[model samples]
Target: MNDKFFIQAGALLGAVAVALGAFGAHALKAMLETSGRADTFETAVKYQFYHAIGLVLIGILLQNCAVNAERYYHWSGYAFLVGVVIFSGSLYTICFTGIRAFGAIAPIGGTLMIIGWVLLLLAAGKK
Candidate 1:
């Protein structure tokens, strides 16, 4: 896999995370407070930041390591990308739209994130 793809995705995710965090802290503060979802929004941003960093690490590992172990990194990194969108995106949408249905999808993202971590573990064991 092209290392640039993972790196770019990670960078973009990190930048978006910061923007979303600030948006939550400022613009969405009042709404979230009124809806009692301030903590939930913050959680979404926090997890995004965490996975963004994880993606960057995956990119770095892929860049430096041999191709033999790229599959795990590839899978894990992509999983994280999807996970962030599904998990964090669900929370953000729910918080903003007051649509409780989105919450049901958050676990799928969380599960994907877990799978990413498990893939990372498998990648490590491969070495």
Candidate 2:
């Protein structure tokens, strides 16, 4: 909700993304390849990393935002966070569990990420 919260969340998410990426590259490499989900796993890691950075930027923007634009930043931050969790989380789940049903959820996450960017655009448009 607030700048501090988003900053903290972003930092934590970024750290986790790095850790997960390393784990996937090493420990899970054979399994992922064997399952033919290596690309999907990498995609999840990439999106997570990208959105973690976006979250940090949104947090910083919130910190410097005009009062009237604060709401947009707040919503954008939430959208980014939730989007990453859903998008990457679903991919990760599918990679590990081999449950293709989770694929359906990835679109929702992508949509949320898109909404986050749109909200960020609106916030930027504000004076």
Candidate 3:
């Protein structure tokens, strides 16, 4: 259940990250560079990749860890996914739209990601 979902989600996210990275580097490179937003695009890709990896890890942990805390990992996996979407997704949009206002949405995603990490930690502590 959680295992398959998280693993599949992670794989999909990883593939998307790769594609997005390439798109940014080649397709949007000129535009982003001209707009001084190449770094922003890279940052979005980086966060996506990082959290994609986290999803994979959460999947593995949820599948194995016997801490009676599958719920924590479950939610953590979801948090990571949502965080990537909100955080990286917003940044991606900002780069394309030149709307700095979207930047405000990133911190909410960051907070979700942090909560996900804390949930993972709590998962380990369960008896």
Candidate 4:
């Protein structure tokens, strides 16, 4: 995707993360505590927020930097987006639905996040 897309997505995701965090803390607090998934929900929100910032940074880099590996920035942004969706999304689903099976998908998202960082590093190493 383009830099603009990444910036918009990041901004939107960041907003959603904030809203969800507040909802979890206020509205869903009792349910989350009852389900013993409050920490998991917090984790999801934290990671989503962190990676949302990362996505914004990636977009800014793509827009302002003159790295020889521009394509890596694109891929890295995509990876971060997908990773946050899958990883944080799955954790959210598990917290809400009490389905442990979704935990299995988190690793894939974590891996994608790692790959995104590695790609960013590769891009930094180039030109």
Report the number of the highest-lDDT candidate.
2
- Separate clash counts for every candidate: 0, 0, 0, 0
lDDT (Cα atoms) of all candidates against the true structure: 0.91, 0.93, 0.91, 0.93
Flag regions of model 1 displaced more than 4 Å.
none
Cα lDDT of model 2 by residue, 17-95, tens digit: 9999999999999999999999999999999988899889988888888998999999998999999999999999999
Q: What lDDT does candidate 4 reach at residue 61?
A: 86
How close to the true structure is residue 106 of candidate 4, measured as C-alpha lDDT?
Answer: 98
lDDT of 1 at 83: 98
**RMSD of candidates 1 onward, in order:** 1.0, 0.7, 1.2, 0.9
Off by over 4 Å in 2: none
**Candidate 2 positional error at 40, Å:** 0.5
Q: Candidate 1's residue-wise lDDT over 1-127, tens digit each?
A: 5767888898998999899889989998998999999998999999999999999889888877756678999999989999999999999998889999999999999999999999988887765
> Estimated TM-score per prediction?
0.95, 0.98, 0.94, 0.96
Which residue pairs of candidate 3 clash? Answer: none
* lDDT of prediction 3: 0.91
Runs in model 3 lying further than 4 Å from the true structure? none
lDDT value, candidate 2, whole model: 0.93
36-126 per-residue lDDT for model 4 (tens digits): 9999999999999999998999888888766577898999999999999999999999998899999999999999999999999998887
